[model samples]
Target: MTLTINTDVIRRLRDALLAEAATGAGAQDAHPHRDAALARVAPFAETMYLVMIADGRSAPQEIAAVRGAVRLLTRDLLEDADLDRLLDACAAAASERGAEVMLQVLGGRLCANRGDRETAFTLAAAVALADDEVTDSERALVGDVAEWYGVSSKRARELLGAMQSTG
Candidate 1:
């Protein structure tokens, strides 16, 4: 079987995701805060591209779905100072380590919000798995953050395993 990949389709998927994230379910005025938050992530647009390319072969529809889901999840997970810091960190990191780093920073913010260090680490690990693979460095970063968040080493490993399996 041959899977045809079009870069344009991926671009559209990314735009759609940003659009969906920009607009709420029912409201039409637009969520300024959400817009601002999305703007922060805007710098890492290439990350989405990288994820698509890294997958080797992907249906445009699949790309669209993932983009939409990511936007929704991000919009829902962040708020207030957490959101601000997340956006700032993402913007800064985008210039340095690129979008993957942004994803890791996001995971950290989510973990901080939940106050459940283990879950946060799991979520971050899961995000890394979004492209169907996680680098050793990414895993190590997740583990380190998990530890900083007060997750036990064993529990962090267990959660990472479970999340990766499920993902």
Candidate 2:
């Protein structure tokens, strides 16, 4: 006898896991203002995290760069533990479903302001180039992120180039 796992079942499990991470017992706001800041930055963080892991591997350099970018963007409004938890949640969600689904979920609600979009692009590019190399999938995912958030391809490429130049 042979047994095959169902994709739908896996998808459902992933959805449930993501939902729980969003509102489960441990997910609590320490302060209203801080929570508000986190809320604003969460989508950006998630988007970058997805891009970092798009190549089916997460390097320490990428993780560190993403965390540093997120911390700078959030301006210490979110605690380190909370930020890690949020990134871990994003990783779990993206790993379970796939990059497109993760991007779609984030695309609907991320980076409304011009600054936010620029920041998102910067964070994605930083993570992509953290290890001094950008894989094809990482490049495509960064473009996908730019497209989803209504950023022009020209601007995205420029941002990536800027990051490369600085480093």
Candidate 3:
């Protein structure tokens, strides 16, 4: 599906990412202020992705665009050293635990909104499948997300199967 992102949503998410990156870099007040600032961004990022996935229009190119825009905004908001730190953090996070952690964060938001857990899991699986191949790492991460949502493996398998069959 062709994903046409909402410019307003993209702009809001971009701004939040930049602000969070800056807060992480000591650009903001010390103490709990930084955490508070970042907390504000978390919901927007999570909700935006949820909306994108639900729309069934999340293409690899669109995902790449969103990631690139976030990175650019982050770099612009933070100093060189801070930007490096943020990038390093992302790399390390992705490497250490794959994308599951990120997915969980987003999942938490969806759960709060009483969203469909099955659909959310399916959407995450679809995101992993966006490249036309579900890598082992991606599959593992999707499984983790499914588990987080209290979805049985059998049910997850069923949902995934249904999505695949329809796609």
Candidate 4:
């Protein structure tokens, strides 16, 4: 079965997060200030791009999938120019330092907030599984993201399993 990450999956995960926050089990600061790095769309898109190209091929479908996800994740805040810049940056970084180094830097910037960590993990996994199959490299990179983002393995599995099931 082909996997598509439309609004439904996004809504489901979002609702789950909201429920957790409402119960105070995963409560963050009530008035947490939005960090630019956290609030902006590029950082998250860059991470998803890294996962998309993890299989060593940036197929058009994968690129489109990432773009769609960034739109959803950013709530349409990612302007066209931002998308252009994000692709350029990813290509430059992937060629220069590589996905490993890129993700490492991204993790440092995003790891402070548990909520962002989970969002990044789930979004990366969504991209990885977007094309109806997860290549070995993509799977490994998703695993790496979960570790670097401080998402427990169990939570990672739960997120991926939900995606797979919905797809």
Name the Cα RMSD for model 4.
9.2
* Worst 10-residue lDDT window, candidate 4: 21-30
For residues 95-165, what per-residue lDDT tens digits would candidate 3 score against the true structure?
A: 56535566676567655543456555554554444434444544555566666665666666555543222
Candidate 1: stretches off by over 4 Å: 1-28, 32-89, 93-116, 161-167
Q: lDDT for each of the candidates?
A: 0.44, 0.64, 0.44, 0.64
The collision pairs in model 3 are none
lDDT of 4 by residue, 42-115 (tens): 66777888888888888665666666665565444445555566778778887898887888888898899888
Expressed as tens digits, the lDDT of each residue in 10-99 for candidate 1 is 234445554554553432344667656565444233233333333344345434433444456555533434434543453455557754
Runs with alpha carbons beyond 4 Å of true place in candidate 2: 1-32, 162-167
**TM-score: model 4 vs. ground truth:** 0.71
Residue 167 alpha-carbon offset, candidate 4, angstroms: 18
